[model samples]
Target: MPLYRSWQTSHAHIAIWEITETEDFFAASLGFGSDKKHPKRRLEHLSGRFLLQYLVPGFPFDKIQISPLGKPQLADQSLHFSISHSYPYAAVIVSRQQEVGIDIQVYQDKILRLQSKFLSAAEQLICANDMQRITLTWCAKEALFKYYGLGAVDFKEDMPMGSLQRTTPEDALIDMRLEKTRETCQLSGLIQEKFALSYI
Candidate 1:
């Protein structure tokens, strides 16, 4: 299957790509030099530069710099964005107005080990039997944190999956409470054998 998928939300534009390796995409698309070959560093470099290019065509090199908060910013400040990746995919969301975030995770046993770090007690009870549900919950909260532009927020202590109402594969509601601020967002996705790729 192709590695890219995208949709426009009421507040922002979202894009997701399934990459076999992050280095291949960054090196080819962003013109990274030989010295910047490490995957994590390359991704950080490319993601900021790419988003700047998206906001301003032919933006000058010296004008691109990430903020102290780690948010990408062009000297022009035309738009805002966030990016994330897991084992096989990288995702980005761009917005002209509201902040946005996107994340993708491949289902793995390691998620079980990390559950307490990301899930609340009530969330665990709600998703105990359904592995896909648990993964989706984790991804949603991570995306939400990224959307908030706060890195390293504890998913269990800082964010909780609130009431959820499932309507259909393409139309479901996910409510969340983060740091006394409440947000209700819609989640849409198709389920593969063991993974669910969610979008909002």
Candidate 2:
């Protein structure tokens, strides 16, 4: 019931969950644990793993290994996944055939000031000072970074977002370029009143 929505892409399944349950619920249900010091952070950590198992039955939680770049991966690479959380919400993308990424971010006014660090001058202008657009842009690139799954990426230079193409009032498709791979990919995104979600 906590699963807010799930979208099945051609090659992967993306799921988002509204974290309405207590940490104990996840801890007990999944036999999962987190050592995060903060309670909310601890909850987010548990919920991420919970969503993974929810998306893929019998996910090998015990076999997850962290790469040198701190990306969690399966040694056999049997499944490629990315997990992200913004407090009360958590999301995951899983693909047995391809690396995947997903991100959910609660809108924050402060992102306006920090935009320069992650967004280039041109990318900022593309946002046109709109917080929803700004947040979606950040999420879009962040999704790309996770998709790359290698650290030391420049959000400003590595991924540039094109103008948003609004598919629906709440949903949009963003064309983003992956400088690292010299390829372009369209990130599917949704802009809500309080948050933005993106996946690649």
Give all candidate RMSDs, comma-separated: 3.9, 1.2
Worst 10 residues of 2 by lDDT: 157-166
Give the RMSD in angstroms, all C-alphas superposed, for model 1. Answer: 3.9
Off by over 4 Å in 2: none
What is residue 109's positional error in candidate 2, in angstroms?
0.6
Per-residue lDDT over 1-200 for candidate 1, one digit per residue giving the tens place of the 0 to 100 score? 23466667777766655544455565566565325676665654565445435544564656657777776555575666666656355566667786666656677877777777778789888778466677778777766776676576777877777765556753445677667355555555434454555544
The candidate that achieves the highest lDDT relative to the unseen native structure: 2
- Candidate 1 pairs with clashing backbones: none
What is the TM-score of candidate 1? 0.73
lDDT per residue as tens, model 2, 1-200:
57888889899998888998998999997886799999999999999999899999899999999999989999999999999999899999999889888889999889998888988888888888889988998898888888998778888888887667789999999998888899899999988877999988
Clash pairs detected, candidate 2: none
Give the TM-scores of the predictions, in the order they appear. Answer: 0.73, 0.96
TM-score of 2: 0.96
